[model samples]
Target: MLSMVRRPNPVQWLRYAAGGRLPDHLREWVLRDVTTRTWFLRGAARSSLLVLPLSSVWLLLPGPLGLRLSLCLMALLVGYFYSLAYLEESCEHKLVKHGYRYGSGRATRNAAKDALEAEAHARYVARYRN
Candidate 1:
């Protein structure tokens, strides 16, 4: 179980973002197997960096409207990024909704490996047997 007060550090968070589980400092949040492709894709989708450049579009408006629009866009960007970044601490209860649960990274990887190995072993047995 995760501590109510203690939060995962940046390094641990990086592990999570990389589609791995948090270190021992944090418990497993994901229950099912997850592939790196899915992990990276989700992280990329959650990224707020896209708005940084898009917000600049307001700057090209050429008047006070541009200034106001730019400020608004910047503000929106900040709020968006803030929410996305802090989702971990404030996000525990909601992880299930996204189909991720905190769990041991090693365990997950081992499970995948075991599954693959089992499949391979089965194939070998079938091919060599009379």
Candidate 2:
């Protein structure tokens, strides 16, 4: 299954991050990328890549070292909060940009979540209700 999934190399990934679309061959990977269990983490990491450099500039301003560090940390936290708040929409947008229909990514993610819940419920029934 892993071999069937062709991942984008670093350069391609950077381009994709910059709003470029991947080739048709990588569409499946794009769907998996936006729908996987770690999608939130991936989104947060991408958000940090944008936020970190801008926040780091605060260090160059003449200020107390602790103050500069605190400001940077604050910026990071605020950016992360907004990123999470918009994560689902952002992912759906990416899917659309990659040639997927709108809401497919959300549907896929929800399906996987529902399957997990169903499996867990079955286990609970077997252990406690039976």
Candidate 3:
């Protein structure tokens, strides 16, 4: 039935964050971005990582207004990246369940082969007199 563990509540969420757990939504949301191969989500996650450090530094700059804005941005980015990481991990786990691995090989090869063989067999039979 594809049951997933429930997401943490607000208090637990805060506690998890405080205890150094990234604020990932967990479960299918993680897999949704990764296994589903959503380009937007993947790209956002990659770009977010690239930007995190720069944003951190920017928050430390001289201007108070800029610092406040940057801090807010940093928090936002952290949440985004946390979700991304969780999604990526979830997707990876899901893929592994189906015998897929990133950079291991083309995961769908067996399925493809089966499909092609079926098609070829049908075509061959269609062309025979019998």
Candidate 4:
């Protein structure tokens, strides 16, 4: 029997984190993995969205580095924050044994969602900037 708890499935989670748009055609293709089917680790691509930027920053830092290392560290911090914010947004719904609750009449939940979205955008830009 299926539990009443409707946990965030992989596609829904990634789509939520992507802010209602797939990052690219390749990413859209990967979303098909969300369906239960033959698979080798679903959601890997979406998880990489959370990883590649930080890994790039780490690899790009100058050796015996100057301000570049500091900059990369700062970039990592921003990525950390963006991940936290997105996680919070993706889990904002409170699942009770019976049903679910969102926002819950609290101004803070919506405030947090907005703040996280903005932070996610900022982090994306910082990571992708040439």
User: TM-scores of the models, in the given order?
Assistant: 0.30, 0.88, 0.27, 0.30
Q: What is the C-alpha lDDT profile of model 1 across 15-124, one tens digit per residue?
A: 55544545443333332213322543444443444444556666666679857686867766785676567544433433443445644433455677799899999999
Name every residue pair that clashes in candidate 2.
Answer: none
- Look at candidate 4 and tell me the lDDT of residue 31: 29
Measured over all alpha carbons after superposition, the RMSD of each candidate to the real structure, in angstroms, is 11.7, 1.6, 9.6, 17.9
Candidate 4 structure quality by residue, lDDT tens digits, 1-130 = 2243244557856664454543343332322323223222333444457655665676565576666667676776676556555543333332211133553323444565678899999999999984
Give the lDDT of residue 78 in candidate 3.
Answer: 81
Q: Which stretches of candidate 2 lie over 4 Å from their true place?
A: none
Best by TM-score: 2
lDDT of each: 0.52, 0.87, 0.51, 0.48
* Winning candidate number (lDDT): 2
Instruction: Score candidate 2 by lDDT.
Output: 0.87
> What lDDT does model 4 reach?
0.48
lDDT of 2 at 115: 100
Estimate the overall C-alpha local distance difference test score of candidate 1: 0.52
Report how far off residue 34 is in candidate 2 (Å).
Answer: 1.0
lDDT per residue, candidate 2, 1-130, as tens digits?
8578999999888777656788888999889888999998887777777778888998999989999999999988887788789989988998998888999998999999999999999999999998
Q: What does the lDDT read for residue 14 in candidate 1?
A: 55
